[model samples]
Target: MNRLSAAFIAILSLSSVAIAQSQPVNELSRAVVQVTAPDGSGSGVLFERDGELMILTNRHVAEGYTKFVIGVLEDLHQPVVPTFTAILHSFSPELDAALLRVTMYMDGREVNLRELRCRRNASDFCIPEIRFASDVRTVSRGNEIAILGYPDIGDDELIYSAGHIASILYEEFGGESVPMWFRTNATISSGNSGGLAFNPATGEMLGMPTSISSDAETSTSLGRILSVEAVWRALEPDRVMTTWEEFLPPNDGLDPAMDPHYGGTELAAGFEPDLFEVEVLAGGSNRIHTLPMECTGYVASAPDFRLDWSGETTQLHLFFEAFDNSDDATMIVQGPGETWYCNDDGSGTRNGLDPAITLDNPAVGTYFIWVGSFGEGDFIDGTLRFSEVSRNDF
Candidate 1:
């Protein structure tokens, strides 16, 4: 009887794994999608695009299937398993990426891609959605990054691995530089081919997961990933990347990101490891790179849904210039669970601490400043600045 009981437990464990694979997605499943390949199954992200498209999965999955199957649980009691039904729309074999259009049109039954609120709006061009890392002010070779996927995993199979970002093949990070690529320890399983690598700090979308830590050979655990640089190049204004080789380009996508003056270095946590020459002064006001906003009369601001920071006295020093006479009302500041730091006075600076503030305390590398209103009925515009540098360099 004891032996039989143990056998039952083993079977249950195996069955549980199967269920996880088929139904519930990992913590990051909101952006995950499973692709049933002729050879085997793999994973991909719900690539952000107009609802007009079905979903993007690893190209090889529906590559051979002219009409692919897409499965989605009609009800919660059913399961998170995809309903295996779709019409192939487009494919790029070179990148091993495929796009399929789901024809079922099941509305009200399940949450669809239309739910994600897009904060990024760079209307100048039509490139793949790329989110800059607001939490990781600086990126290095050792910073931890997680890759989410559903490689040949069974039903209960969802994998999450943390690894150091190793190399910046294309560029140190983002902007109009070369195609971006990063390397990490996170093992890319067979089913995780088209998964996603997210910066856990801010929940900001980084890049699509590709290649395994161990290549076709189960040899080493050197996981590699490509950044939005590759995806952006495919959609640059005039930049035409017709081939994969052309996309990879020749120059190391490092120098520009390391340049503090021109590159979007302020957007990331700190300089990528390769930027040894760049120097960042501590306690310097980051208003230089912050968005320009002015105190526009105060009101009850919805508690910021952002959970990236922990602070007792939340002071906001916006980088703004007085626009006109209407801006004379007063600069007031308020936050949930905290007192308003600045009262609506005609003072140009809101915090009242100083014309420029160095957020030296707590030493949190990144934060977001939401601009709403001044006190009374006035208007102003300013930008948010970083009070502390990620890495302290004289």
Candidate 2:
């Protein structure tokens, strides 16, 4: 061969080697585990929280089954079954996300972290925690992505496919909108559900493989990937760190439980509470805050608030007035106990979409307030007011 041709060939060989070295396929594969339910099998990503291990998968994979088996792919595509038992911790059908917590074995067999023989270490089985992409805004059309999972075609072998983002879709429901999924040409099939879609350049998870679509007349390859934001939102309160002061302040007020409103038998004279104002973006783009109150309810949007009430008596009144009347907004108040309250329009008398809540004999404790837009275009720019009322007001 000529000298120039030989030099060109040498450069191409070196470039291919560098590219292969950059991809951490082995490490990424270790984070992907085989999840088998009573009816079928799929893939899941291993995550660690507070020193305990958990698996993040699609709800359909673990739904209807109280318990399932988690196995790691060993050499020659064989799966090494760990004695660990995974129990369903939480699942959301809307988001298509499920969280499974790993409990000790049922047979009383002791297993150490090093016994799983996961990534990086031969002696230790500790699976490395997968890093999720923080900003979905960075993922744009045509961005290169990769999927790691146990595709049925692989026969229990961890498979990797590289592709690029094709299109993005937003699903709107209950007055909120969010990036639902991204369409891609990534080679995904049965058993690939719940597998992760990551940026090969950064190794940051962007989404999760959920399903694939095909055209009958024309040939097209596209897979729908659920955005990682859904997973992050479902598992946020446990993962994000914040202090009590961030939600509410120390209680300093006359005992209202005995009298109801600040004053007994009458509304408290000049009982005015300061208005707390917050700015929230549309489409649930902000971080969701946990309310100090202990109750069960869903916050449709971010920029939520909490109030601590130790001196409450019988009736509680909460008001939310948004500046944008055209913006359809909703307010939810959950607290004290199992009691929950929500309002779409405050009194239905005002021009703006304001929400008001009145609770009688509310349990004395913290209360959570969530202000959210009803659709994709609404932004939260308003004031939240809290007051105590007499039982008669209710």
Candidate topping TM-score: 2
Candidate 1 lDDT trough over 10 residues, lowest sum: 282-291
Count of clashing residue pairs in every prediction? 49, 8
- Give the whole-model CA lDDT for all candidates, comma-separated: 0.44, 0.65
Clashes of 1: 49
| Range of the 10 consecutive residues with the lowest summed lDDT in candidate 2 | 252-261
Q: Taking the tens digit of each residue's C-alpha lDDT, what string does model 1 give over 265-289?
A: 2322232341222121112111111
Clashing pairs in 2: 114-124, 114-125, 117-125, 175-374, 257-313, 293-366, 314-361, 346-354
Per-residue alpha-carbon lDDT of candidate 2 for residues 1-394, written as tens digits (9 for 90 to 100): 9999999999999999767745566667777888877546788998777666788888767645557788774442455454467777767644677888777664756545555435554433457658888877668899988898888788667788988999988777335576778999988888899988898887888888998898878877799999997666755555422222322222211111322111111223234542333443322332222222311122333226656665545666776666666655666655665355666566642664566677776666766556655543346666655666432243
Give the Cα RMSD of candidate 2: 16.1
TM-score of 1: 0.41
